[model samples]
Target chain A: MDVRVDRDRCIGAGMCALTAPEIFDQDEDEGLVVLLNTRPPQERRAAVRIAAGACPAAVITLTEQDTSTAP
Target chain B: MQHEPSLTEPVTLPTQRAAGCPFDPPAGLAELREQRPLTRMTYPDGHVGWLATGYPAVRAILGDPRFSSRYELLHYPFPGGPEGPLPPAPVGDMTGMDAPEHTRYRRLLMGKFTVRRMRQLTDRVEEITAEHLDALEHRGPGADLVKAFARPIPALVICELLGVPYADRDRFQGHADTIMSMDAPPEEGYAAMAALQEYMAHLVAAKRADPSDDLLGDLACDSDLTDEELIGIGAFLLAAGLDTTANMIAHGTFALLTNPAQAEALRTDPDLAPRAVEELMRYLTVAPTTVRSALEDVEVEGQMIKAGESVTISLEAANRDRERFPDPDVLDLHRKATGHLGFGHGIHQCLGQQLARVELMVALPALLGRFPTLRLDVPADEVPLRTNMNIYGVHRLPVTWDED
Candidate 1:
């Protein structure tokens, strides 16, 4: 799955980081959103979903990959 | 139409529900939640307001940028009263502000409530809870857990957060109580806010002169925040930190006592406490409702909420929605509740959540461990619930335990 964050819409609420800090980090100066993984491996799908769900602005979007196609 | 009622109505305030202030909503609210779900309410002064009781709609309104929190602090045009505007809302604080202004004020105070900073206070919180438990042990038998246990933990934690001397804790508690009281006349509420601000100003001055590791000192040194803003944040934490968790601790204890099965589960396995705490928070939603105004005309679920109309999001209702929580009424310790609006739903979500969680995670287990066999001193129905309280909670919870 790929995770994307619209930084302009981000308010630096930090909920994204709170939900999945492993895959999300915030710029310390402004606390704006940052994604540690542009495309997370299959095993990290749940963390990506949590990050999406916990985003207060609903800015994070996850596009899932069909694991059956993966090597 | 009447205001929409929260979803917990079926269990907490069923049509045949027992009469009391805490457990049951007032007739107007219960009728609204159960029947209308989504409807317009006429404020006492005859103004029209939207009340969204349904889960999806309320959550959307809270998270939607179209809504504003600023108008919440003003005197609204009510449905039927004097021709003049309704008297200004007595309590005005940061929760009522929005956007750049809100963001600025929030930034000044964020670090204090962050998980990183709050972690340092956990050892102190445990020490305080242990001390309370020790006192309860010495004064064992019948004791009001609310006064001795639930209330002190938050009060002390808030004091530490504000850099206030522990000796002043009682004074802050008094102000907090008045601000949260449903029956408090607007005058008393206003007085409480002012008194709290005054106290915070004095504390800020002290912190200015002599800085410390505490949050208040950090805020005091920040040049970005005005005095009013600093005083306001201090006042905000003082009241929020005390009242919200105090109610949660008390109500959660009451919930566990009534649901002995859950209590036993926690007692047998301490690991159950964290999840159990989350369930308690979801099931016994302390805030119950939060009000936000429309920033502009916005449509949700095909309904139009005009700009400036006040809309209330039922946290209690949303958290318990069967769609989100199967068997919404049941207190399942293991329920995988990923999204509950207990703290809130958007950018303005409760910053103090981590601090509240740490307190509960520690307090609940420590509380259970202290008196595993503790049972209510009075019948469950006999305990008084604080009804119409600005926040939902029990008035007093009496429990008795015998030491081995």
Candidate 2:
């Protein structure tokens, strides 16, 4: 899955960083979101999804990977 | 269209918080919530709406996009003879707006409130907290905590944020206080509202002419937001940031004094102050209720709420729901009070929350630490509650401490 934070829309509620700290970190200066790992491992998907859903500014967007031809 | 008064008769809004236990939601409301979470409610304006009193319903309704938040859409339920929704919240007041328009403003202003910025703000908030504590100390034992400390901390923080000239604070803060109040006369409130708008217009213009490092100045030069929009946004933010946090500090202190066990916990751990703030928010539920209109036909829990119908969510009742929190009335600083809607929920949840949280975490503990003997000057019941106003708090919290 592709993950991203729209720095423009991020309110820095820190819900994303708090929920999935490994993949999502907040910038110290502005407190805007910092995406540490865009495609985190599958085991971490639930926390990532919850983080995106919980963002007040709704900045996090996750796009599903097209795996139609996966071996 | 009365529908023959199902289950129980329509209950009014602003039900008195039970006499002795001023913190609890009105006993009548708890009974109503128990009978059925949702029920028909009539507004002062003669409009009938749905009132959601349960935890699940209140929380869900706030987050659900199907509910409209536009100011004019929902009928105000407060006792002041429900008039039109406060003359259409100025152009950029996102609280009255829905998607797209709200999205625009929220996106533009979100960066300024990031947790990183707010935490880094710890130094500034601490400085402000210390200044107020010093003023309180110098003034000695008896002081209206509300006036001397609680109100000024957030008021000054907001003023500095917008770069409002220090000279203009006396005039603007008075106008703002009148405007935010639920008890102010219509004539006075409207006049103050207009004056505040004019003052903000001039301030915004000044920022445009000479942009400074402040939020308003940065917004002036950075965004394509119009002057009027900027003025509206400035007032919106100022009003939002000031009263909410101020009331929390004053009321939270009162709560801690009355519930010394919780205060003692904070005194011992100090680290518990952050969690204590959230617990206080949930326990007090300061901004008790909110209005939203259903944009389309929808069935919530079993009832079919038709389009254009308004719903008043009783946040106080919801926060105190026993299902959500065991012994909901108790003020336990250690309770993991996450998911509480004190800062509200969903798309329109408070934008200034991080700032408010930081202020509470700083002010509450510092005040407690500064004066270990801090206690109320008057009988607990005589603290002069701000029941008439929209924001719930003490009009004047008279408190004193033993001199060292």
Predicted structure with the largest DockQ when compared to the true one? 1
lDDT of candidate 2 over B1-404, digit per residue (tens): 56655685666664777677868876778877787888888787777778999888887788778988897787878777347554556687898888878878877787788666777789998999999899889888999999999998998888887787756777788887887787776778878877888889988989999999999999999999999999989888887777899999999999999988788789878789777877998998888878899999978878888998889988888888899989998889999676677877777878888788889999999999999999999999888988777778888999999999
lDDT of each: 0.72, 0.83
Residue B365 error for model 2, in Å?
0.6
Candidate 2 overall lDDT versus native: 0.83
lDDT per residue, candidate 1, A1-71, as tens digits?
66789876665556667667777876654456778877777677787797688677788987775456432
Per-candidate TM-score against the hidden true structure: 0.87, 0.90
Among these predictions, the greatest lDDT belongs to 2
Q: Give me the runs in candidate 2 sitting further than 4 Å from their true place.
A: A1-12, A18-23, A26-71, B1-9, B84-86
Q: Compared with the true structure, what per-residue lDDT tens digits does model 1 show for residues B200-310?
A: 889877878887777778777855666676677778877888888998888888888887888888878888766777788788778776667776788887777787666
Q: What DockQ would candidate 2 receive versus the native complex?
A: 0.33
User: DockQ of candidates 1 onward, in order?
Assistant: 0.39, 0.33
